[model samples]
Each structure stands twice: as structure tokens, then as C-alpha cells.
Target: MKKMPVALMLAATVFAGVATYTVPAQAATNSVVKPELDEGMVKLEVYFSSYPPNNYSDENTGFNGWLVGVTPLPNGQYKGTYYGYMY
Candidate 1:
């Protein structure tokens, strides 16, 4: 009985140690770019001169722009809009 408890505790300790082990995180070296527009996809370009209250503007251009892609649904019945911002 004593040996059985000792063996079970040892097995539990080993499992706990393995569960706590983790790989170190790494920093990305390459930048991620958006995918190219496919056929039948619609693109919308938006430019902003000034917002409001604070009147925020892009530091480099004094304005900002966004590119939105609208893709057709898989069912071919509707379209879905996707937007992403990268700074």
C-alpha cells in the first residue's frame, strides 16, 4: 500500500512538470501583408481629412486612408465586408 501511494505521487509529479513546460516566445522578423484582391471582389478606398473634437490627423500626410475589401459570400447570395488597420 505504501509503495503504491509513492509510485502514484511520483507519476503525478512527473505529469505536472510536463504540463508546466512551455516553449519560449519568439519575435516576428518579417512583416505581414494583406492578401491580393481576388476576382469578383470589390475594393473601397476611404480618406479622412480630420476627425472631430481633437481633430486627429496622420503625422506624415496630415490625413489617413483605409482600404476595405468586400467579398462575395460562399453561398453566392450576399457579400461580406472585411477591414484591417496596420500602423
Candidate 2:
């Protein structure tokens, strides 16, 4: 599997600015139950705790899915994530 780019990870995780991420007062929480990987692919596991419990799976199932893809830049100085562009 390809390793994640340091810069891209930094930009996304480190220097990334934050905005209010609103969630419904209900719904089931997420535990990243499973991931189906393709050949040469990998994943970064993340955890979520819902305020109302089981939010993602229960009520927010549609708008609340998961991030899946990451690709390193040509020069290897940066990386991009499919999740970054997605909600």
C-alpha cells in the first residue's frame, strides 16, 4: 500500500482550519465498523462518538458515511483525499 504524504497530512490534519460541524441531536454513533480494501490500498481508522448515541448509523446514516481514499501527489510533497472534497 502507498504511504500517506507528510505535507498533505499536515495540511489536512495540522494546519487545517476548523468550522462548525453541526450534527443532529439524534442518530446512532459511528465506529467505522469495517472497510473493504482494494489491492495496494490502505485505510486510516477514525472514531466518532455521537452526542445522542449511534447517531451516524441510526439517524444520520446518509450524510454520515466515511472517508475512504487518499492519493499522494506527483512530487510526493503533498497528498489529496477523496474525503477532503466530500462533505
Candidate 3:
């Protein structure tokens, strides 16, 4: 009966270790807009929270969705994210 408890504890530890070591692969959230520039320029980046609209209406423009822009600081030291909408 005591052996059963020890086996359970060992199984739990193994399971926890496996869970900690495994990481699920996920798609990147943002992508660099300009990677060619190396110095003195705040790199621009853009990312979409959701897939842009595929269909367009007469009154509404297509590709209306959440758009995020990473703007470089004027000092060229840091970057900031600006959220905007389309349509």
C-alpha cells in the first residue's frame, strides 16, 4: 500500500516535468516592416490581431480590422505601438 503512494508521486512529478519542458508552438504576433535598415532608424513593424476582411462592400472599404503599427521614437532609441482601425 505504501508503494502505491510512492508510485503515484513519481508519476505526478514526471507529468509535471513533461508539462514544464514542453512548449506549444504559436504564430508570431508581429513582424518587422523594415529590417534592411541597420542604424539610426527606428524600425517599423506591423501586426494584425485578426485576419483582414476579405470581402469589400460598396459603402465600406475592404481590409477593415485591427491594425497595429510600431513607430520608432524620434530619438531613434525606442519604439512605440500605435493602434488604429481601418474602414
Maximum-TM-score candidate: 3
Residues 1-87 of candidate 3: C-alpha lDDT, one tens digit per residue: 345688899999999999976862222233343234334323222333443222222234222222233333445432323222333
**TM-score for all predictions?**
0.23, 0.19, 0.25
- Write down the TM-score for model 2: 0.19
Judging by TM-score, tell me the better candidate of 1 and 3: 3
For candidate 2, write residues 1-87 as lDDT tens digits. Answer: 999899888777644444223443232232333456545443332333312222122233223333442233355332212121112
lDDT of 3 at 81: 34
Provide C-alpha RMSD values for all models, in order: 15.9, 18.7, 12.2
TM-score of 1: 0.23
lDDT at 61 for candidate 3?
A: 28
**Which one wins by TM-score: 1 or 2?**
1
Native-to-model Cα distance after best TM-score fit, residue 19 in candidate 2, in Å: 30
Clashes of 1: 0
Clash pairs for candidate 3: none
lDDT string, candidate 1, 1-87, tens digits: 446688899999999988766531112112143456565433333333322111123456334323233233345432322232323
lDDT of each structure?
Answer: 0.38, 0.35, 0.38
